[model samples]
Target: MYTISTKLKVILVLVGALCFSVTVALAQGPGFDEDVEDVPVPFDGGVTFITALAAGYGIKKIREHKEKTK
Candidate 1:
């Protein structure tokens, strides 16, 4: 039983490590041969609004829970 649990733990650790692996590539800018204008990413406003709404909802829920407890 102990060996099985230890093997399960080791498998879980390996799986977790594999799941969270990240690959990133960084470059200074457009190459000297290429000319480009940097354009801002789209839909950021919607994302920001969604994030704020979620945060407000969380805060409201916390406040209600606190009031109920008191």
Candidate 2:
């Protein structure tokens, strides 16, 4: 039988309660919606491709740095 200690149970319950509260707050919060104008900059296929490539390269560099530290 796996018995949970009082201290552990209390910590777990507190964490769960905190998470529930955060979720509820976010659910009721004002945020961007479908009606909002998400007007993207007018970019052709070449520009879009270049932007994606640059972003991917930046992400790859960050991941490599993180891996080296660990």
- Model 1 residue runs over 4 Å out of place are 1-37
TM-score for each model: 0.45, 0.39
Query: In candidate 2, which residue pairs clash?
Result: none
Best by TM-score: 1
**lDDT (10s digit) by residue, model 2, range 1-70:** 2355877888999999999999989898577887888889876899989999999999999999999999
Q: Once all C-alphas are superposed, what RMSD does model 1 give against the true structure?
A: 5.7
Instruction: List model 1 lDDT by residue over 1-70, tens digit each.
Output: 9999999999999987766663222324545654667778798688999999999999999999999999
lDDT of 1 at 11: 100
lDDT of each: 0.83, 0.90
